[model samples]
Target: MSRHLRLALVQASAQSFEDFAQGLRSLMKSPNAAELVIYPELHLCSLGAETMSEREYYTAYAEPLDGPRGMALAGLARELGIWLIPGTVLERGADGAVHNTAVVYNPQGELVADYRKIFTWRPYEPMCPGRRFVVFDMPGTGRVGLSICYDAWYPEVTRHLAWMGAELVVNLVQTSTSGRAQEIPLNQANAIVNQIWVASVNGAAPTAQGHSLLVDPEGGIRVAAGMEDTTLLGVIDFDRVAATRKFGTSGDSWPWDQFRADDSPLELPLYNGHIDPATWRPAISPETRNDLRPAGPVVFCRPAGENGPQ
Candidate 1:
């Protein structure tokens, strides 16, 4: 059996929710329809700074788990006979808080998982933060991890999912043109450090950077999209993930094992939890490793004897 699984990354525009559905449908028309398709964060809504003041606009877009957009994405998965992650949408929580949630659908058109985004960057976006990360089983692929936009910024989120035995991390993002340069490299770095495959999908340019990228366990870009509305296809070889983890960057047997042996650096009780820190014991003889290095920018001299930004 082939260990390679095909995936489709839909670089959609910030049109209406219905328009996003149509874009996905058009992408799946090809004979190469993948076993899995992913979309960007806030795929169903606009992320322009002006939208923040329009409370009624969000009120109209926010829907329950079984809303119209959800139904459309679920139906598409069933019609295409593929698994789907319909990006992050505005969801109205039972507690009256609005959540930025990523919904997953199985081939059977059933909602398998609904992951609320945990790391919401305040001032950038206004939404309730999710408390935990979610990992689910993908039939052909191994365990899959799901995160949205800002969540990928924090390494702890990916590390937690990696420790939970996730083989793939799918990040749904919505970034501006200026942010893509930084976010793309950050995503690649996370995949390499975790020794797992990563698939990042984002909306098109103007509103988003639209540089959707798929990175292998070794931090190789398998497929990437430009700044436009289009669908990108890529394949992931499960064997590569297994091989990379077994023989990590420096021939180390699973890097996470040796690196994560001590979680003392993460003060759980003090950071988020309400527990008293005085009861906790400090880590003894912690290993110190410096991975930082200085990097110089590439400068291109123009024909006119002028330098350009790297």
Candidate 2:
């Protein structure tokens, strides 16, 4: 059995919900319809953000995960009969705090997984930060991890997702600054270090500095788009991720296979923590980590200290 996924990265400028929906419908009707369609971060929420104050913007758009916008996005996915990731939204949590969240809708119109942006862009981005990491399996395709714009700056974000058995990590971005140049390399570096596929989608001109790209398991750029409104399409083979890990990157470096279960822990003063070799292995094998399987619901990862005392 071959595990393959057809991906569509929509690198377009921010738009109103009406325009966004229309564009999505047109994309689905195209000859090259993709299995999974992804847009850049806040693509739908940026419509009137420029006119409103920061607080006003968040307050006006923030809604629950199952809110109207979410339901509409679900309907779009179901109607199109494809997996859809319409970028990040402003979520109004039960605790009343607003968060920048990314949602996933399966082909059945089910909202399978939602991940909030863990690394909010500080003072500029006023939304509350999310504490958990998220990954969801795509039945026959493969496992996918979610990350937002600023999260790519932190290597641990991708590292944790890779450890959780994610074959591909999608980082949704809406960058308009010159910093996009730096982000491009970060995308490739994340794929290289984790030996996994990476798809970083950025918004197009006017809304962002679009340089959306897809990096292969070996850190090679498979497809990249310029700063324009365009859709990048590619066929991703999940088996390549497994092969890369097994055979080594470029057939030389094998970071994941180098450690032994009995190896001593390597301490790190940064987080006052140590990498325990016993549990440092990738959680890809079903026989080893059944909880990671796609049979159940979405997986929410709480890092070391979140659950309780370490």
**Model 2 lDDT-worst window of ten:** 301-310
Candidate 1 C-alpha error for residue 131, in Å = 0.5
Tell me how far the alpha carbon of residue 255 in candidate 1 is from the true structure, in angstroms, after superposition: 1.2
Q: Which sections of candidate 1 miss by over 4 Å?
A: 47-54, 250-253, 259-310
The TM-score, computed over Cα atoms with residue i paired to residue i, of candidate 2 is 0.92
lDDT by residue (108-154, candidate 2, tens digit) is 99998889999999888989999988888788667889999999999
Q: What is the lDDT of candidate 2?
A: 0.86
User: lDDT values of the candidates?
Assistant: 0.72, 0.86
TM per candidate comes to 0.79, 0.92
Give one digit per residue, the lDDT tens place, for model 1 in 1-310. 4357788888876667566667667767776478888888887766453555758757767888887777887888898788888788889887778888988899999998788889997886778888877777665445677888878889988876665556688999988757778888888988888877899999986677899999988888888888998888888776566566545655664554342323344435646753222222111101111121102111221111111111
Against the true structure, whose TM-score is highest? Answer: 2
Per-candidate total of colliding backbone pairs: 0, 0
